[model samples]
Target: MAERDEQSGAAPGALPRRAIALLRRLARRLRPRSVRARATLGASAVVALALGVASFGLLGLLENNLTRNAQADAERQAVLTAGLAAEGRLDTVLTPDRGIDFLQVVDAHGRVLAASPNLRGRPALSAARPSEPGTVRGTWNGRPVREEHRQRVVQVTVATGSGLVTVYAGTSLREADAADEFIRASLIFAVPLLVLTVALVTWRVTGWALRPVEAIRAEVAEISDRDLHRRVPVPGSQDEIARLAATMNTTLDRLEASVIRQRQFIADASHELRSPITVLRTQLEVAQAHPDPDLWGELVNGALEDTVRLQDLASDLLLLARLDTAQTPPSAAVDLTEVVREVARARKGDRVAVDTEIAPGVTVRGSALWLARIVTNLLDNAQRHADRSVLLALRVDEAHGTAVLEVRDDGPGIPPADRERVFERFTRLDDARSRDQGGSGLGLAIARDIATHLGGSLTVQDSERGAHLVARLPLDAT
Candidate 1:
């Protein structure tokens, strides 16, 4: 068989050895690359370290126990030999039934009087003081004992013709050393295999634990802003991974809603601008065809109206954009009462009966310009719709820590369903209402946005006789 293996170039166990090497290569290639790999490596290293330390400690303890047992047996036999020799029956103690390697009766001068069959006439096994009694190595019957061999001795006061003699009885360590070596060899193979088994188990457990996280990462990676409607898969496990996936889905939902609102805002702004642009173009075309001074005057006046409307719409759009991005309003105190008074005094209400109920010194923290715009929008909205009268009231509600402004007009009160919708951008209840009278549908929207930006709110209130609007703001300290 040896000759055939040499000829074929296939050593014993060569096929299995090659298979193991191939498996090792494949395991290395399939090793984890992400956090899972790191976890597996870390866990496996810890387990291997713990198991190795424990195995080494246990093996050392086993060796010590075996050696101690051997030494104890030798000591007991030595004591028995001393008792036998003291009674002058030393010959009966050297029987084949005795379990020891060598037995000797030596005089004080170190001469062997009686010995085991194998060392009948040899010198004493040991003469000098033992370094570690019962565990030292020495020669026996012209043969050298190994360092691992165990031995024990005792002094016996044996009766003799002239005086007393000391005898040494001991056992060999052949059996104990054999058992220890076997265990040591077994552990040398077993510890590494045990460590490898622990590592494999740790790797598998770590992979199972991180599977959900990897799935979430892959799913999230495929989502983009344009496809925000897509949601990540939530794991059924009630763990951090499940919560993370749920939070991600919720964030996507908000982003989708924001995108939809943004698209709507852009579409409305374009439509509003196109109206004025079309009207201006028509007037210019007519002026160009007429070329008369009186007609030119009318055309220019009409164009100017359209231009003013365009400028106002542009300004409102810009303001809304700024409010959208602003974190806080300007921190300046403005008197709501004074703001309302200024608007009431500047109005040219020749037909509408403007009634004012201004409470003194109602102050709030915000930009003066934005405050004035809020008051103006409320008053203008009322003036446009009121048939005969518009009531404006301002008061500081000391109990509520807020300043309030109320504007009511005796016009068609808004329906309960449309109250909330009226504050949306570019919303108009009556399409037939001329642009000059309705102004822009953005007035209420801009008013509400400014109020909200300044840490206040504008809302419609129930009114039996007219459309009522209320604005509230946090009051500056007294």
Candidate 2:
């Protein structure tokens, strides 16, 4: 209330109002996105990331296992060849068709000792070099050669007393490279299929999640001023969307009540204006002839009073209309205490002894003109009903975050049955609250409208002794 809004000519307060507008825009554009884009995207990213990491891991394991199998095959054959050397049949055992391109035997020195049939005319096998087991890549003659990114091979020489024997056996890295290409191609094709399937599932799930929002929009669109009693469907789930729908329905309920009252106000106002016009017309008709000289002033005065009533009814209706269309001014701090005192003092001449009990700094958010009229109308009603005493109460409830104003009168309180009826525009009670007592009947209507426009409400509080009107305004503590 007191700390609301910035100072005049200063920057406007920023908050949920702006944030809500942005969300509304996003909701509009990503109607699909809202349905599940966010959730689906999150889920899909997790799955995709997991898939990539797993693919790399799985392939590394497969390559390791396959390369081990290839190396063991070469070692087993070399062992068979070593046994054949003892059988004096080494040349017969180390033959073709065992998945080896060639076989060779070498000594410790750089001297060729053996060659396979295919490489007999090619470079001869040299003595084993001192190196760790690993694959190496380079150009073999004029042709390019590639080795495994992982697999390795080496041949160590065993010392015989007179010479050295080399066991040159290990898997070919070139073959491993070819097998890896085939494995990689398989993953490249399979991952897309997996991703595509996941994406489709994501789209479906997102749409399912967003169905409640769609239903709410449809229900809201169907509910217009003519049918404000209509409520948006609430989802059974106690999730965020369900909460949103419930809140919107509550808002619609309030809006519907306000709109209904506005229409009632229009109808009541029509009758109020029509009644006065009829009176004025009758007066003019009676005065058409040579009017009685004594009754002339009284007749004119009566017509003048009717004219004034018409003016007040019209003015009140216009104010309600404006309130319905008016936008809230950027937040402004206002003192309810000052407004109550000013309105009470202005109406003091009517013999209305106002027992004011406003806390000094009681405040709220609203236009000065609108808030002043609320006080004026309440005070006017109190004056008519009060025999000698009317009470004005204004206070800020810090706990509730609101400011309250109450006006009560002891003079013949409104009947229990008609208490709610008095606040209606142009609905003057048969005897006590008749227009004959100077009620335009729009006071309560206008007051309530102003209260609503100020983001508050006006209602009749239950009173055992007299009529009690309560107005509550939500304070903007921006």
Candidate 3:
């Protein structure tokens, strides 16, 4: 019971502390959150700001007008008073109908002679602060006179005996002060209301702006590895964010395609792997059952041959994978004429006819390995079909600015219908003259990929010359 009481008293847990802190921050942001609050705050703030600037301007203007009016009144009255004091018309100047006050007269001795109404011969002019007539503030009658922000006017002139004469006048400013107070009150009241209105409006506008993003995020969240075909929603306009969403959807589409291709490739690889393993196993079983040494040797050779095919297929697969990220690293300024000569020199027996026309200094930019594969695949394909001889030709197409490699076999060529069909993996021509050389059939496809990757082309051209396979490579500046 003591332990439970202690846990509950005078101490807080970390979670409670954090929660309290969060709630405090939230409380600091508390307000009337609604459309009306936002509108009111926004409109009121704009009006208040405009009115504040206008109030300062107007107050200054009104004060200036008051000062100018007072100064003009003092100047006119000073002229009239000066003329009257010169004639010693003191009684007429102090007439009850006149609105002036605190009048005095002075002689050359600096002594007040006849003062009027509230003054009994007091000095009206101060020698210390003398100027042309202007508005000011001071005290009178033992009361706090000349309230702050109120206006007063003073006038002075020379009376008889060359001594100066002075007059003092003032009025209550209750009406003007009250008006200024009302303006301040209105501005103070409106400003906070306007601010609250603006915050509410901003929150609503932000929500509208983020709607498309929220939709895109929700759609993207639903996508899984199994359902990558789904795409993020695109907004109406081609804004930067919209384009970004579209790009993400495009990337999603490409990823989906890649996933599909990878699945198919896996299936294809499994089937290809199964064939060789089956052949090797069958050959080994036959060798084990029949104990004849010659038969065992033949069976072992068959198994070894199947193993070699498997190795070649696996190597090709690995090479293709590498090629995805591989630059043609072993590039050289290779002359196609020299390449043809080397291939022809390395060729065996009368399986192919050697025909060549080497352009003098034609060079191509490509890796030798890929370039060699391009040539070997065409020559081997030609050699397989050609009964009499295959013709090898090399030349430069000056018009096209391309280095051309041509291998023409006199055997039956690809028909116009099937010319595009032979490059696919494991594709065999349906034609009778086509040879079955136990090829994996990925050679042409790989060759085409390499050629294109090297900024060149591999093609079967319509040659009036013979059954044609031509490869064209670019001659970039060395």
**Top model by lDDT, which number?**
1
**All candidates' lDDT scores?**
0.76, 0.71, 0.66
The full ranking of all candidates by lDDT, starting with the best, is 1, 2, 3
Over the stretch 1-478, how does candidate 2's per-residue lDDT look in tens digits?
Answer: 3345555433354556677899999888865445366666677778788889998898788767766676666656555554444344445224633654445555455444454565454443433363432222221221211222433333444444435555444445555566678868987988777877888898897788788899998988887666788888899989999999989988987888878877776677777778899999999888777578888898899999988888877788787677668766435777777888888777665776888888787767777777899998988888887787889998887888888899999877777788777876676776655667758877887888788777888988888777899999987576
Report the Cα lDDT for candidate 1.
0.76
- Higher lDDT: candidate 1 or 3? 1
lDDT of 2: 0.71
- The deviation in Å at residue 35 for candidate 2 is 6.8
lDDT per residue (tens digit) for residues 171-197 in model 3: 334445666677678767765566566
Better of 1 and 3 by TM-score: 1
TM-score for each predicted model, relative to the true structure: 0.67, 0.62, 0.65
Question: Mind sharing the TM-score for model 1?
Answer: 0.67
Clashes of each: 0, 2, 5
